[model samples]
Target: MYAGNSFEDEIAGLEEEGLRRKLAALPGAGGKLTIDGSEVLNFSSNDYLNLANDPRLKDSAKAAVERYGCGATASRLMAGDLILHEELDMRLAGLVHQQAALVFPSGFQANLGAITTLAAKDGIIFSDELNHASIVDGCRLARAQVHIFRHCDLDHLEGLLQTHQRGGRKIIVSDGVFSMDGDLAPVSALRQLADRHGAYLLIDEAHALGVFGRGAGLCAELGVKPDVVVANMTKALGSGGGFVAGSRDFIDLLINKARSFIFSTGLAPACLGSALKAVEIVEAEPELGAELLRRAKFLRGLLNEKGFDIPDEASQIVPMVIGSNEAAVEMSGALLERGVLITAVRPPSVPDGTARLRLSITLAHDEGDLHRATEVMAAIALEAGVL
Candidate 1:
């Protein structure tokens, strides 16, 4: 279908642009992935609470496997609707104060389902400019006129909403927390605009579940309830999969109309079991949420003191603007050299020349870990002249 020396040609094309993506397998990229016996402090990964390897969560998954077996051989519309899936869905819905919830295979699927199912042929979808990749794709796939307002720009959003208030269904979508920038969306303002325009509000809270809202989301944390919400169990839940929570009628409609959910195999029982346990853990140990925030704050303060220009938001995602993908990658490599792991977020994942060293905090990391990581990053930036 395509011509080139395959891998080599692909690399050749990306080489000049400083973006050669190769699949180099690692033994284990769990809570902390290793390289050449050098432990990079894990600032990369969606396991926001480090629950990926949590013993309790793992045990629950094992128990579920013993009870329910390994794979889901059929789609939900067929023979794959396990009881565990329903239970997890119900509990997740309860967690977010939604009337109902449906479990999808991933956060991406949830976004795809929600955006595609709700908006109709005659609707106008008003979305945030800096929404997640899934939301962006979902908007593209959705059969509606998509109007992207500036990132969290309520004024611009209002302007668009006012212009489109004449007819047709209207919907607004945003992320509870912007993944790359680590900044929160203005959900409160967005909700007001939705109310004024009689539009529905949808939020993808993939990065804001456990660490935010006392274990809920920005909507709950800020006391702003959205009409629809989608989240991932992979990040803070420390499990795998995604979910959509909202009114029972809305969820019921998705169960019927969302092709991604209806045509896909149900979430495995182990994942469902683990997600249930993860939700339980969030409820039982609110201190874990507090600790994660504490660590995030500590890292943010430390990086700021080092003169790294970070945004003034309280989120686990802390980013340092390195200006070049090469510098960003080099900084990540340097941190690894010092026994700390950080990821370089470059173009496609982010805008070009805005490459950043993204550091995500979790309860698993302590002050010593934060201090060590900060010193390592600062040292690397100085050595690389990025400081």
Candidate 2:
């Protein structure tokens, strides 16, 4: 019999590659996780607004937990429908200018449910190649004849639309904000494409919410109307849930058909109430949005001034592409040692040979922190031979 060592040795050979090999050695990430000996600055988390630590949101969660208990005893369809959930959903709909809204356990499940249940049979989905994993998975689950369009490539999208316009049910879907590249989708063009092709449009506003659209999403920011808009409260809302906003009929269709929602337990009162409060904060304190953009611009500029090739964008995500996974991991580790935390994103999060540092900026970080982090990054990059 062959030894298990054979398979182990094969896995060990992954280091010879530049992508997955580096993540294998990544320093600890996440707020609760540590990479290397020091607790790295959290640049990888989706917590964009630092609202996770906001006193108001925390207090809301505490109050709800005290009032409603820790968890829902049953699925929403079976009795988990808390009043707080309805309030949050309605508020999100108002924020996004949608006729109705429905919440889900996570943004991931929201996409899964919305796309799959709504477009399952005889449907064709046109998706951006650079969309988030959840969107890609959702499209897969939809069992649609998924058509891939190049990242933000409106030209390619049009070509696909012309080629498959005969679809019984068709939808064009994309991320409102590309999480890794920190770039905006060509939503305006896509809207035009959807119109031209007679296809419904779905925009996942997970990252865009709270950061763009004055806390709603890019759809509101760009003044574009999609057939559906899905978002997560976890990232910027600092809560743990997702929502899909659309026409009352579309939302109703999802409520009855979305397996992710129908089968899973609903968002607990603690998370729902906290999310409701977070939306209120965004509604009232519009300045937080400007501050977020300002800080992101400032940070990207500092990185560029130090010779790092970061693009100028208002999005919270900033990627510093390093050629090899090994180099990317090393850059993050060295930065951590100097007290600047960054996430080394390697394949399959990114394509092979596109190992990069995914820096997620937040309003919580000040200019001083940016300067200190930039200096550390530059010094570490030079030492690691990556600059």
Candidate 1 local accuracy as lDDT? Answer: 0.85
- TM-scores for all predictions: 0.95, 0.92
Instruction: Locate the minimum summed-lDDT window of 10 residues in model 1.
Output: 22-31
lDDT of 1 by residue, 1-387 (tens): 467668767778787787865554655544466677766567777788888888999999999999999977787779998889889889999888899999999889999999988885667899988788899898888878899998888889999998876556799999998899899998898899899989999988898898888888879899988999999998989888999999999999998989889999888889988999999999887667667877788889898899777788878888788888777777777777788777688888887789888878876677888888888878888899877
What candidate 1 gets wrong by more than 4 Å, as runs, is 1-11, 30-38
The residue pairs that clash in candidate 2, if any, are 27-35, 28-34, 28-35, 41-341
Q: Model 1, 94: alpha-carbon shift in Å? A: 0.3
**Span of ten consecutive residues with least summed lDDT in model 2:** 22-31
Candidate 2 local lDDT, 85-190, one digit each (tens) = 7888899999888999999999999999988976777788999988889989998888879999988888888888888866568999999989888999988888
Candidate models: Cα lDDT each: 0.85, 0.83
